[model samples]
Target: MSSSIYSTRRWRKLRAAKLALQPLCEPCSRRGKLVPAYSVDHIKAIAAGGDPYPALDGLMSMCVSCHSIKTNARDNPHAFGKGWKAAFKGCDLDGRPLDPDHPFLASSEG
Candidate 1:
């Protein structure tokens, strides 16, 4: 939580990349909507011992809400059972699997 995802060259690169690709958000793309990119999430996290880029296959773009969810899960593994190991398992604050595509699974490929 202290020194993870939030601080990374990859995130910086991703933020710029997202703008290059589209100013809109990815979820909005799926919904046929166009919204600004508030956060470029890992779709995976670091504390969970993940490599964001490799895990998501380069799908590293999310909004602030999305990014925070991933960050929370990564920061609180003990609160979750089995550590919620998946590349696309978004859950509530409690850590129960939410929408599989909620965008928090890219933490690692292992």
Candidate 2:
């Protein structure tokens, strides 16, 4: 989905209200952290047949880092698959990901 939808005035108002009500990141809270929420994420992702302007039923507070992780997971489900996970275990934890073919490995050839 295009991010332009989130730039709408209506969405801005809703996002403000959502952040005010829940200032803390929902996922971080669940993981026993207390980081402030920086964005209002759609609980049901916009790419997965979710409504662009969904009601409050499909929204939650998120930090930027957590939001990125969530988005990456949704966009690349195959990366979390059994074989992929095993392959990912061999990757350097601190390396920048340069390989387009492997989600976790950073290709030195690049």
Candidate 3:
């Protein structure tokens, strides 16, 4: 079952609009894949102090698999470990990490 916030009409409309704006899974696309989006996810989770109704850029379109992986990593960190966000296997064509949140990229930012 989804959270009560997700069941709200406002959230539903935002979700639809996000999907329409970005039909492809954002993470998969970054990895050079062309997977269709199955859900809209908040880039910054509400529980983490993100705005519930943030702008389109604050949302991400994700396929079911990616969504599940991200959710498990974020919501169940104890079971999956803190590194779960970078757990997606394989790399892009240029040998770059598929996960944008990979530590390699984070380190490079500075």
The deviation in Å at residue 11 for candidate 3 is 0.5
* Number of the top lDDT candidate: 3
lDDT of 2 by residue, 1-110 (tens): 56788889999988888888899987566556799999898765577666767776467788887676656655788644443233223323345331123533224436
**Residue 109, candidate 1: alpha-carbon lDDT:** 31
- Measured with C-alpha atoms, the lDDT of residue 107 in candidate 2 is 42
Candidate 1: residue pairs that collide? 43-106, 44-106, 44-107, 45-107, 50-107, 87-105
Identify the leading candidate in terms of TM-score. 3
Tens digit of per-residue lDDT, candidate 3, span 17-95? 9999999998888777899999998866787677888999888899988888888887776846444456555576777
Residue 75 of model 3, lDDT score? 74
lDDT of 1 at 36: 69
Estimate, for each residue in 1-110, the C-alpha lDDT of model 1 and write its tens digit.
63564568876676677666656665444444466667665443443455654433444455565455555655686744333334233444556444433334333234
For each candidate, the alpha-carbon lDDT, in order, equals 0.51, 0.64, 0.79
Please list the residue runs of candidate 1 whose C-alpha ends up more than 4 Å from where it truly belongs after superposition. 52-57, 65-110
Q: How well does model 2 score by local distance difference test? A: 0.64
Which rank order by lDDT, best down to worst?
3, 2, 1
